[model samples]
Target chain A: MAIFVNADTKVIVQGLTGGQGKYHGLRNQAYGTQVVGGVTPGKGGTDVEGIPVFNSVAEAVAATGATASFIAVPPKAASAAILEAAAAGIGFIVCITEGIPAQDEAKVYNTLVRDYPNTRLLGPNCPGIISPGKCNIGITAGEIAELPSASGPNVGIVSRSGTLTYQALYELKQRGIGVSTCVGIGGDPVPGTNFIDCLKEFQADPETHAIIMIGEIGGSAEEEAAEFIKANVTKPMSAYIAGVTAPEGKKMGHAGAITSGGKGTAQGKMDALRAAGVKVGLNPTEAGDLMAEIVATLK
Target chain B: MDLFEYQGKQYFARYDIPVSPGDVAYTVDEAVAAAEMAGYPVVVKAQVQVGGRGKAGGIKLADNADEVRLHAGNILGMDIKGHLVKRVWVEHASDISKEYYASYSLDRAAKKHLLMLSAEGGVEIETVAVENPDAIVLLHIDPVDGISLDVARDAAVRAKIDAEAVEGVADMLVKLYRCFTEGDCDLAEINPLILRPDGGVHALDAKVSLDNNAGFRHPEWEAFRATEELDEREQLARTHDLQYIGLDGTVGIIANGAGLAMSTLDVVNQVGGTAANFLDIGGGANADMMAAALGVINFDENVKSIFINIFGGITRGEEVAKGIVEAMGRVELRAPIVIRLDGTNAEQGREILANAGIPESKLTSKPTMLEAARAAVALANGN
Candidate 1:
């Protein structure tokens, strides 16, 4: 019982004719995702790697009855693609394109909240989500996440950065722990989802007994997540925040990973998570070990 | 992508928002000429991105050509809060009747656009937000619906703006919103949206920050990029298309992702070693990319040792190992290198590295991030 996606979830690819779309679409298909069809504006009659192509999302949805979508269009076309998917009534959408202007994301997000309340948008610049051994969406390498343990998936993982998401999952796998689902909400300043949003889902999933959250400096999202965890979450959580020694006012690669004017420091996030009764690890391996301990005690 | 005062004013003018007539000048002679054209009494304002220009005496009033020359001479080449003044904006001074504050920015928590308006202007908005929170009227605008005339008017009234100035303020707000959206700006701010003696409202100062992600839509932003000032190492990294930040330490750290790169820095510090720089080679760590990254790190004289931490997901460990070996042949290094390889065929990658026949004095490998950090730190400290 993973959140958002599972074995029966059928998916569609947007901009599937493009290089990135075709590459990851095949990968998602190989990972056992039911990638039914793809959408390309001009090449409607063609098929990409044995997947049927339609000119519009509506056509693809009607033809294949796909419930989820993966967007791999360029930055300029990303907002329109997301809106089209939402308008077509796709329940879940994950956008993997980076460098979409913040203004475009803001507009798309506002529309999603006000007009299409049912649709859940995952990322505009992220690696996307995966429910291990069931389904894979977006560009997370499918091989790293181990198959579910015989006890069923016990831990849920959420992160802002892509590689760290893979790192956390790999570490947990080494400890003989399997995941219910892992979501990379992205490192953009205005992401479609936040830490709290994923936390809420993890709490509701009966299969997820504990959670691991990977955060970094910049924005108050981590601090806000800590507040939500203290109030709502009953599941034990372990956390790690990167960039403790990162200098202020300099962007650390990721668009959203910057320490501003004494706020959004790593120390601040570490303190907030600790106050929420979550064990905070100084690094990735340490955090995975802490979560492994929590999973070990879950009878 | 922070715009200087002159550039911000230029952007405001594009939206037909009222701003004082101003021209940028790099020299005192140009300042005097601009003052003559604008018809003094003029204001000589230093062009620097940092705040507190006034408190630092970067702003001065010049009633004549001689005063303009004197002030401009003093202000140019002056250091204002560690930012050197490279230019000045000469403008015709306005007769201010009142001051108000207005700005539009993204509210990450709310996932919406935030509008801030205050009747108490000409001061730090942060101070106002902290001391008298209610004095500043906050409005969340839906991006699709935008701000209606009624909503804009309500914001002005709630800000305690004078009755006569409300209409003009609302009009300015609407124009500012257009500027913010059309201009693809993350922040469009007017510190002192001043009211003139003759019942005219104008933008006295402009502070804008454009989203670099939106560069594709606005090709004109190339002008802004051209004016950017970067240090030697930063310029080199920019040329190589590597995400690198220079620091004053001995260990040069490189990783595949931003989060891992930052974590590498933290782990190095935890092991009693400081990082010379932060470099993210990104997802594709092929031979060419590794060579470019290594070249950039070698240019930093402060670096005594280098750490390459790659946890392959989309990038395979064997490919990374080959890239490192190939890169070693491309560049001669001043600092010893420590490689930590993990994920996706890691054992095969380690075997490849072991059989490369590289000297242990110049190259060493560790299996874990912690051990790699300790080795790099010890080597950097000349242990």
Candidate 2:
């Protein structure tokens, strides 16, 4: 069984009255997510597209035993929303907002670990995870996925970026490849799950034969995850490191893309993954084919 | 993201922290008036966001009104770490007997709320740790429990502060913690928490960075944000909702995707020419957006050439070309432009730009980041 969001995952939307919140909530409901309830402070009595609304996450959880929450609230209220979900016993929280202060994120992350030990946090800025042909918990371009192959479903993608995941998946679909699941762990300086955390889940899933890890220009998470893959993961894996040419001492793309001081360069990540015996694709276009070749060889 | 010292002091005062009385002044006469009102021996601090101002001669002690005027005149036009000082902050100078430091911020690497306390704090704490590693004490406060009095006391002892100051420091630390969390601050640093000869602690310096993500809650922060300090080009870009960062290079960049735009910078560096700036118009880059992007780059004196790299997904290539054409019609191009388009409607987009009288070589219809980078660098370097 896939970890995190799957077929049976019941979802609740926080900030459902907002534009983006309503748009994505409706999409998730259409895709068969059991979006049982929503939370909007003043608009508690109203319903969004047939979904019940409540003043708080706890009240919503009490009415409907929602297991997961999709947080679309602004950054300031996001941490409070996560805490609210945690207090309500929602097992999973996926935050889609970006631009959260590093201090607030740290506080939320630490609280999740210490106060709610059993709760799993997906992202504060990520697109969230998608169990293909099932349900999507966060914002990812679902149109990028190709139909299932005649022989077997092959690739699994774990990326630090959300938009890059869509681009990578688009390129993969061009070659008629399908993903078992694509997890966007987010590119914040401190993400809820590290690269290894997602890799561990991917490696354990029997349906995911090969994995493509798409990383950006910053952080030692990819390098550290490579070591774990070598020791623990038995699945064939390939990687594509983005932002290979990022300038020194600049936050080029995402706020998290800046290496702070060259601590997590693309070359550093690529070399580490390669040295760990993982096939590293030079670019996103070649990643799917490289993983396909590796899977073919393994067979 | 960084707030000026005066702004940070204002934030601290709002949180009930004991900050010295200060008034920010933009003119030399205003500085003298503020200093006179603050009384003699006032401190005239240059209003720049970066630290080490005291070392840069930005912070000066004025014994009288004449000294205040002299220091303010010298500081108003001074440059500190790429920021030109346009204002002075006049404050009542305290008699500092002992200096200690306290800060609350998130340690991103450790994924914890960090409290840094040090006894040797008047100088740069980073330097002190590099030279005397034992002078600073760091505490990782658990997010659930937050910073408690016990943790603050332990940090105080580790920082080598006196026993008499421990309880007081602990109390201040607790309030600072509340300020840090409630303020939605990325960092709240009080360097040189002065132990006055009268036996009380005062925050001599305040460095606070609010989280932009939390801005939805703090609407009042908009007034405190000094937009005047931003470069004219950057300010214009912000007005147009573009993400642009100016750099010291000849090749001006305009890219569709943020990831691709960043990779283009790497390729530019690989080919030996520096990137003038980063301009990501997002998926919404159209003819108008392109014009704004070009105008931003053109505003920079260092930009010798323009490079447009777009890998159209949600953004249409032909529309981008039209935007460039439209922008060209309005703002006179100080430098030549190189356009590279790929993905959806890429070939047609190239055709639109080429038909508009731009040279075929300048309007590249390539998909590779390396190819576009090399071409742009060659054109920019005139090689």
Candidate 3:
């Protein structure tokens, strides 16, 4: 079975009254993600087209029994919305809003771990997760994903970068390789779910034959993930670390994507992955192709 | 947003964390007056963000106003590690009996607040980490329970802090932890948290990085924001709300998503061309943002050819194509552009470019990212 999400997962959209929330929320519904309800404080007892709207996450959870949440609230209120979802016992939460301050996420992360250990938060600035043909969450285009088939191998993917996740999927799709699940962990400095968390799930999934990981500069997450891969993951994996040519001390768009004081360099991450028996790709396409080779050998 | 020494002290003061009494001076005369106000035998330190200022001769002691003027005049306008010192912090000197280290930063792997306390201080913490890892006491604090006096005291004692100064250091540690959490600081570091001859713990240096995302809550942060130094390209990009980092190269690069932009830079470099800047349009690859990004890159004279790489996800391909075609009309280009357009509805995007009537001399589209990189590099070399 696919990890984190499947066809049976009931989902609620937080801030469904807003522009982004409504758009991606409805899009996810179209992809058959079982979008059960929406949450907007003042706009309760209403429905966005067909989806029921509620005053709070607790009401939405109680009424529809929605087990997952898609949060599209503004960055300032993102943490509060996430905490609300966790409090209401939404097992999985996906936040698509970017630009939430790092401190807000750090505090929210600690709160989630302490109070709601069962609640798994995906991202505050990520593309969210996609299990092709089965379910779609967040902003990842469902049309780009391919299901398990006779002609393609079902590989699992996890990445820190948004568009690079899409690139990896597209790269493999062109080569007739399908993905069992694609998870974008986001580029925020303090993400709720990291590489190790996602890797653990992918490793246990029987349908996921190979793994494709995309990481960028900044933080020791990738280096740590490399260490985890060496001991745990038996599946063939290919990885790509962006920002090989990026200079020191420059924040390259993402809050977490930067080389500060000679730490978190792309070369350092690449070296760590290579030493861990991971086939590290020099660039995005090379990384995708390397994964394709593993898939071909798998089936 | 790294706070200067004076600003860091002021930030620490808000949380009742003790820091040296200091004032920031922009001129030599202001520095002399600040020195006089701080009392005799003051220290004049450069207000640059980079470290190793003491080794760079940017820090010195001034026992009198004349010495203050001399030190300030020498340090001001002096370049240390590519950063020009426009201001100096004047503070009263302290007699230190012992030096220690204490800080709070996010441990991403642990998903908790990392408290690092060490008896060894007044130097780079990285060195202490490599040389004597056990000398540093690492504590992971949960934001829910928070840090109490007992927790701070326990960590202080375990860190091998001097027994006489343990209480004072622990008290300061509690306050420092508040500055890290409640203050919305990404990192609140006190290097050489000094134990004075009187057995008092004082912050000799404050290195703080305020979380930029928490700007909505901190209005006073504008004072620090105003003094941020920006170069030509950086300043221009700021006006457009585009993420751009200026680099020393010839091929000006623009792409959607941070990862793609960085990978674009790597691909350009791999093909034997250097990128002049790193520009990520994010989700807004629309007409207005594209023109704004193009204007910023064209402002750089070193740019020989522009590489516009777009891999659409939530960012639509046709919209980016129309933006590029429309942006090309608004701004006069100095360098030819090579576009590697793919992803969602990319076929429609390619169709729009082919029929746009924009001559090939100005815009050239490639089939793949690799081909586009090669084309951009080749065009940059005038081949």
Candidate 4:
């Protein structure tokens, strides 16, 4: 009943031999995800965490019928890994590697859009997605998310920042709110998926009663999402825009979270969301509390 | 990393994009020598990363050595919109028959490469987009296909570029696209792509922002890092590989992620305190990372108190607590610290902190971010 991923979504690890890939792959499996197999160049017959390894994504897919892939390769090899996974016909790909060159991402994105229209790329620098009690992909900690409620998960969460994503989920779960699916789209200048993309999916998912979006100061993504929400989304939504007090022009650690030419300020994003009839939280905890209130009212 | 105009020109030259011959000068003598080498009627352009340099008198045309000396002397230390100009680019000024604009940047919303072309050049492109939207031709180039000759030609025509200049402009656009993609630039811009009276098109101004993530591919970028002028605290943080931004507040704030770091600053402000800096130790909050982060904050004189907020997801709070205790032993602090530990293994982390026998006056812990903010703000205000 969760959004992008559920119990039946078979997943493979792209860089299973690497440290991050092996570590998070096991974690995702432990969280109930079907980590059917892995892909590693040259180490075809090996196994990681009882999962069989193949030399290529095609072999892994053929062997395990893996529909989704988690790419944990280094920056230099990430684009190639994504292209290979797409070519192998993976319907969903989550790239967890950070520090990937923008041009490489542009090439990957362009290829996916033009050649592999069915493949959904999640992130180049993100924690990936977690649909509570069903499956977990990428590196979002499985411990923080609430187990699925009897009423089914109600709040669908989307965020640009990883730690803030964890923080919001933790707060909401503590307040007895469960998430249908939480997607971390990453904080790069260009992400494979965006807030609006996730919102559309959340809007259509019957299990998701309310949505909580966490955005940081950067670009026009949040403002654009506000416009989309006004036009399409009818579900109750709450939002939190980080970096309200951040000085303009200075990048607040995230590549995408820079205020350029006095645009993309936190106030501007908050104002846009509010104007679109979305309740904006001043901080992470407040945002979680607001979403909890909405869920309570839904009950 | 934003390249100075002179640096951008050098990068453009590598791609064989025509640029006005130029050399960078740090002093008046160097400026005079550069002017002589480039011939008279040189443009003394202040090398600053910020915009509005021309309006700020950071740029001037020097027809003679004396004028070069005068202009260079004035511009060498000129502060243009908070960015101090440390050097000047002396170049042979081009004769402009017309000015055009071209750039290649990523369109985040579209998740594609964006090409912006405008016949209305030598002005802020934002203003042009707002005022005369049709004057600029915006195209989203497919990354796989890239910018073809026909696409470049169509963009030039749609931008309403001069008929004779369209071919040269189109050629330049193709090269610019290559520079953008191959050069690993987030933004490759030529504000004034000038068409000369002699039927030539050259880049009069260059603005290239290289993606730092692609540093592994380009080893030569170390030279760019060498010339970057960082403040004392910022320089210290850089050496330790800590992501830190020096601010003018009294509460030195340190957190795990960028989002949390920024939110920490906001929360401090909400509790009526100003943050002295924004420091993200990143995912691993080991002893070394914490020590380095603490050392950087300890070096700042404006800091009255330090706030260490950690919400461990992959990073365990027990490890973070141990790191802070060990880091506290490594550095001599001028200010007290308030720590808010939460998430995975947080109780164990708190127990470790409590049993460490650290003085309450120097180190204290709070149960939540809000309470911790209040404690840090109160301590920073000498309460």
Off by over 4 Å in 1: B316-323, B344-357
Q: State what share of the real interface contacts each candidate retains.
A: 0.79, 0.43, 0.79, 0.75
Which residue window of length 10 is worst by lDDT in model 4 chain A?
A146-155
Candidate 4: segments with Cα more than 4 A from true spot: none
Evaluate residue B29 in candidate 3 and report its C-alpha lDDT on the 0 to 100 scale. Answer: 93
True contacts kept of 4: 0.75
lDDT of 3 by residue, A1-299 (tens): 78999989999999999988898899899988899999999999999998999999999999999999999998888989999999999999999888998777877888898899999999988999999887888888787777766444688999999888888887877787878899999999888899999899989988888899999999999999999999999988999999999998878999888788788999999999999899998887898889878987977
Please identify model 2 stretches exceeding 4 Å from their true place. Answer: A1-3, A7-18, A22-69, A73-90, A101-104, A114-116, A146-153, A174-178, A217-220, A223-231, A234-237, A240-250, A261-296, B250-260, B267-274, B282-383
Write candidate 2's Cα lDDT for A97-148 as tens digits.
7777776787778888888988888887787777766777766645555544
The per-residue C-alpha lDDT of model 2 at residue B134 equals 81
Off by over 4 Å in 3: A150-152, B345-348
Please give the ranking of all candidate structures by DockQ, highest first, separated by commas: 3, 1, 4, 2
- Between prediction 2 and prediction 3, the one with superior TM-score is 3
Model 1, docking class: medium
Model 3 pairs whose backbones collide = none
Give the per-residue lDDT digits (tens) of candidate 1, residues B1-383: 88898999988999999999879999999999999988889999999988899999999999999999999999999999889999999999999999999999988888889999999999999999989999999999989988987899999998999988999999999999999998999899999999888999999999999988888888888887776767788888888888999999999988988998999999999999999999998865676777788889999999999999988755667887787788788778999999998865678888998999989998899978899999999999999
Q: Which window of ten consecutive residues has the lowest lDDT sum in model 1 chain A?
A: A144-153
Q: How close is every model to the real structure, measured as TM-score?
A: 0.96, 0.82, 0.96, 0.96
Ranking by lDDT: 1, 4, 3, 2
Give lDDT per model, in order. Answer: 0.91, 0.79, 0.90, 0.90
Displacement of the residue A103 alpha carbon in candidate 2, Å? 5.0
